[model samples]
Target: MNEHVPDPAAKLEERAKRKAAKREVKKTEIAASTLDALKQLGYANTTLRDIAAQSGMSLGSLTYYFTDKVELITYCVRLYKAEFIDRIEKSVTSAEGRDAVIDAFADELTRSMTEDLPTHRLWYDIRSQAMFDPAFRPVVEEIEGKLLETLTRVVQAAGQQDTSAVPLGYAMIDGVFRFLLQSRDRHARDNDELMAIFTAILRRIF
Candidate 1:
């Protein structure tokens, strides 16, 4: 009689699944703690050691979990970009017509990104850091690509294909973003007004 043995392929698949689940958990923990560190230390000052300490993990552990600072920042960017895009897409898709859809999309986007002061601060940190560092440029570009992709799709769906409108739309928000964070401290209430004006621009272009 031969001893029973587990199938090797099944064993490997189970191991892989477990590894993936563990990675997901670690990613969540890292994200939460890293964001907290970002708040406390700001973008340029925050280090991997700080994040590891906050998360109650060793630097080696964080290294195993993330390739580098760029990877971690990219994760944060992905989270924000996804939230922004999801809200805008939902509002636009659910609206009755082109005008309403564009307006609602703008409103939702502004509402999501600036309704919280911390969110605006975090964005300011990431965008500023990306501008000076070679390591972060790709991450910023990737985030920007995702952002513009969402806007472009929405604009096209609304019945226009002005390639220039993509950057123009971006400029409108960038101007508002700069004004909010730099020219003056932004309040939550300003979100509604910003959204209205942005939508007005999109409506004109589209």
Candidate 2:
């Protein structure tokens, strides 16, 4: 029997991989805490120290993972919005028919608005910041592009051959959601109204 020998390079590579994985886990935890803070305070008011306090981690530890508030916010928002997009995509794709698709899409929007209001508010706050600060525009545009692509798929599923109205439909949906976010009442009545308008818009596009 020959004795087995561990290669130094392989051992070093394995250690590096473990370190990276641990780093990612820590970053994710920090991002979740930052997201909570951002949701409550919005982008304008949130700071790195606030994130550290929220996360219960020392400021030095937090700064080691993320350089500043912007980097932290970028990571949090990207992680969240990617998950958000995946949810809407699943809802739209799983529906059985055109009307079902429309209803699913509209219901998901209503659910997000009512249940995840803080997250959406934080999203809108960051988006508004993009208007004034060029640094945030790239992320905003990337998110918007994904949104429009999903809307286009919805329109196509509704039997619309001409996809020219996708942008208009997206605009209408966004406008309605933003407007509803302002209302104090998040009752069923609000949901019904939004569903009606959203369904009507989809029907008109098709």
Candidate 3:
């Protein structure tokens, strides 16, 4: 029997892979920790030091993973919106019919607005900033495009062959969402109103 030997290059490569994986995990942990702070403070008011405090890490340590607030916020928002889209996709997929899809979508939207108001507000804040700062536009546009795609999927799953109305449908939904976010009385009545609007929009699209 011949003795097995580990290649030095392979060992080095494996170590590097582990290190990169560890770094990514740490970055995600930091992002999750700082998300609520960013949501509460808004992008303009937030800094890397603030994020560090939120993550319970020193500023120098935080800067090792993310150079600045913009980079950190961008990563945080992308991670959050990716999860948000995943939820919408899952809800839409589980519904069996057109009406069910519409209801699921509307219910999810209502749940998100009512339960995660601060996060949604942060999203809008970043979107508004994108108008004046080019740095924010790419991520903003990417997220909006994904959201539109989700809306389109919802429409198509609802048996709407004429997809021309999808864009208008998305705009209607977004407008309602933004309006509700700013509304002071976020009672069940507001949710009921949103459900009604969503039903009407879905029916019209179909």
Candidate 4:
């Protein structure tokens, strides 16, 4: 019996899959490094070289993937938004009532603030830059739209009658989160405090 050999096309396909997978892993690593750098050095202070060092990649390799800081920042923002939406889905899915939805929102927000405050801070940094930077506006708007959609769903689930309350609810949460990001007293921004404040705001809106 003759031994079987892999087809050239099959070999090429497998190689392509492996390459794509590796690229995705690298992208995830780069995004993580970008967030870390933003947290440590801030958006204005962070350079591509800083991200490259954080990611443990050569600057040339990083540029091959990201081209520039703007592109890299946009990619990281989308990655962050994707993770956030996933968490929102899980948090809100099992909620049974308005109060339950509010609880879910509060829990998720508190968890995010506590577990990954750096990413939240990175988000605010980019979000603020988006206001004046035309290149950043589209992604920022897209992410904010998705966030508002989820917020609206939560508000509607919580028995909110007013349509306007959706944006209002988002504004409330955004304000508090921003305050936490900028607070001088870091110890005061506990999960319990966040939950209480979010619950009260949601109750008022809904």
Candidate 5:
């Protein structure tokens, strides 16, 4: 005769998994509401109370997750970080080595800029602060460093190795990013024209 025994290890693992799932759900709720509040009111104008209210949670709850507004913005920066790299990487890969990589990049840049106005505004808002806010420098630097690395990889894959042109290549994209984000509210800009500019500059650099 054999006796059945309960697996203590399996039972403990299941409990741990349930707790982790609950924590993840709570974190997702907070991040979603936090991002919504930022999109609506922007960084400087948005407050903890506003986030708590929008989230349907108490101020204490918001504080429990994030010590302050700085932490919230830092979290947002981290959240969007992968997207930036992915967008660039996709643009580069989509064009293949023979197609105009710069034109493909411009398409990706235009897609986000034209379609995502709220985020466009948020970026400009943060960019405006980067000049005056010392605390924001590191966040900005982290983004810049990652973008440079991604572009460098693209250049390497395209059979280009001159690092000297990296800065120029970055300048091209930044100009396009800003133009799409900055001018559309007041003036009509042509996406094709922007693509032309990007392709022209990229060919020389690569």
Candidate 6:
């Protein structure tokens, strides 16, 4: 007896799915490389060739996946925001109490300032560019709104009665970030000092 053969139409569909999966994987790989390239080279200096080289894909292959640098950057920004929001939610949910909320906030800030500096710098680079570039505005607006919403949720969970605390909290944090980035004399602040300042801001806001 002959074994049953798979249907041709079903096989075609499976092949299409595999192709789509591979394309998606390639897209993500390209985006990841683009992010690293952007971090190392800055937005203006980063090129498609750099991204392609970093991704281990040829320029033609990268272009086939992403039409141009703008498209690739937009895709990377969206991916970054999605992952960032997920992380914030997970971190906030895992910790308990207001003190824990403060701890979580400080921990995230520390990581952003130190371990995640490149990503944060890339974020600001995009943010500054978004002010003048129409292509980046939508994503920047969406990311800012989503981030504020996450902060608001965390504040509420931390027993903060004030609804406006999120904005104030972020403003204070942003001020600190700017200070650290701009000030030449602002070097070598210990974790204790940083956490103290963060806790003080939380107290004022809450």
lDDT of each: 0.76, 0.82, 0.83, 0.84, 0.75, 0.79
Clashes of 5: 0
lDDT of model 2 at residue 41? Answer: 85
For all predicted structures, in order, the TM-scores are 0.82, 0.88, 0.90, 0.86, 0.79, 0.83
Show model 1 residue runs off by greater than 4 Å.
Answer: 1-6, 161-164, 184-191
Tens digits of per-residue lDDT for model 3, 102-142: 88887888778767788788889889999998989999999
RMSD after CA superposition, every candidate: 3.1, 2.4, 2.0, 2.9, 3.2, 3.1
Leading candidate by lDDT: 4
Predicted candidate 4 versus true structure: per-residue lDDT over 49-147, tens digit per residue = 999999898999999888899999999989988898789778988998888987897888788877877788778888889889989999999999999
TM-score of 4: 0.86
Best candidate, TM-score-wise? Answer: 3
Q: Would you list the clashing residue pairs of candidate 2?
A: none
- Per-residue lDDT tens digits of candidate 2, residues 1-206? 98899999999999999999999998998889888888788889888889899999999999999988777887888888888888888887878777888888778877777678888888889899999988888988998999898888877776667888788878877887777776645544577777776677667666
Q: How far off is residue 95 in model 2, in Å?
A: 1.3
Candidate 4 or 2, higher TM-score: 2
**Global Cα lDDT for candidate 1:** 0.76
lDDT of 5 at 61: 82
For model 2, the superposed segments whose C-alpha errors exceed 4 Å read 1-8, 185-189
Ranking by TM-score: 3, 2, 4, 6, 1, 5
Which tens-of-lDDT digit does each residue in 1-206 have in candidate 5? 77988799999999999998987678667877877888888888999899899899999988887788877776666566667679779777856663467667666766666666676577667767888987777887888788898888878767776777887888887776687567777876677765666666667667
lDDT, candidate 5, equals 0.75
Q: For candidate 1, lDDT tens digit of each residue in 93-140? A: 867667876778777756655654565587767778777877777877
Clashing pairs counted in every model: 0, 0, 0, 1, 0, 0
Error of 6 at 66 (Å): 1.2
- Model 3 bad stretches (over 4 Å): 185-190
| Greater-TM-score candidate between 3 and 5 | 3
